[model samples]
Target: MVPKQTAEIFQILSKGNFISSNGSQARLHDCISHDDNFRILKEYFAHIGYHLESGHNYYYFSQQDETNTNMEKKLEQFAHFIDVMDFFSCLDVKPVTGTRYRVTQIAEECFANERLRQKIFALSRKDKLIDKVIEVAGSLANGGFFEQEDEDTYKVMDAIHYLETIISLITIDDDGEQKNS
Candidate 1:
């Protein structure tokens, strides 16, 4: 039998929002990551024209489309979002999709590491280290790449659909050169 919150789960996934395993709310995290619950919900979701997608302790929605227009738009959006995700993924905290981070910690690192400082300084698009990091995180958040936990911390989200979309459009050469196909 399908578990409780079946409608709620469908609502969350249908909109392309992710239900992360490490979601800030413990109950929410547990609900989506439940082994049997997820499987049951996954089967239920298939009837509504969306496929339930699983990530590292997370879940999202996906739809099949063969048109290039929609695919290209998704790729364009994902590319920018991916760069921002990379910036956060580079942090020492190793923030999981639902982990919290503080601006002070990143700023402290900037002060100590010359490389990080230089990288911060080199960002002509941003002025301060915290802002630069926030800008990156915010961009990803806006693109649904990650979810904002608070003013400082950001939680990684289950946006792997974006990654899969981008990867499918890219081609690799024998020498390891990547090009858009």
Candidate 2:
């Protein structure tokens, strides 16, 4: 039988969010990684209808099939993420895992570049440059790709590789075409 903590772990992973080793919840991550605990939890969760999955220093849940509405929502969310990623990529700062960035730094960069400011405006509903930076960074943090280290600083999480991997899988075909599905 799985321990109560194991059940609690399952509940967290069941959401699309991730559990990271170096994240704020390090204790929970360590608890999940303890000797033979992952194996036991995997088996127990399978019977209860969840497939436990792990990635580099993180764990999340994935299922075989999703409903049409669920798929649509995910695809739309991914589209938004792709735009956010493109905006960040345009910045000199790359969003590689473990990179630390400050809201003020990004806002300063945006203020220096009209194109960057435009991109930030598109992604953010906030009016001020700093607020826009905060909004975008906050969104990434809420998505589990970044961890807030302090009031205005964030460190990218290992789970960011998940988004990068999905983005890399997106391909444009020959003859200026894009693949569907």
Candidate 3:
């Protein structure tokens, strides 16, 4: 494994983001997928207390447990993701991996639908409709789930499957009760 590539992968995963084969960072994804590279990286990252985890065509970091402050931040981020997912779901757009979405298209839908507009406004404090959409997309892009293809276009990366899978594991039971974590 090349030392530079190893360090690059470490920098990305260390941030709690994913390296995905179909993401904007295809070169880095290919680097990590090379022969013995994942193994080498797992051993390397283990020394720093982050377990290297792989999913589909992606890799990310995981810890056995987190500090309370870290846990709080993660929970808060997850809550925001839930709201984002809800907003997309309301558009009848399933949050499927590798899906491409347009900010202008979403904004148009929000303009036509009062409920969607309200949801978007609740998610962001932006005064303009377009700014709200941009803010939401920017958040997902920063998290590595979406990649901005252009100013108004974004493509969902394979890393999004991680978020979808986590959300799917949250089960609701009889009498509309959510399962205890």
lDDT of each: 0.65, 0.83, 0.86
Best by TM-score: 3
Worst 10 residues of 2 by lDDT: 172-181
User: 84-129 in candidate 2: lDDT tens per residue?
Assistant: 8888888897988778989999999999999998999999888799
Per-candidate TM-score against the hidden true structure: 0.67, 0.88, 0.89
Residue lDDT tens for model 3, 89-130? 788566567777889899999999999999999999998899
Which tens-of-lDDT digit does each residue in 115-150 have in candidate 1? 766665654278677787677667656555567777
* Pairs clashing within candidate 3: none
Candidate that would win on lDDT: 3
Query: In angstroms, what RMSD does candidate 1 have relative to the true structure?
Result: 5.0
Selected candidate, larger TM-score, 1 vs 3: 3
Each candidate's clash count: 2, 0, 0
The reply for model 3, stretches above 4 Å from the true place, is 1-4, 176-181
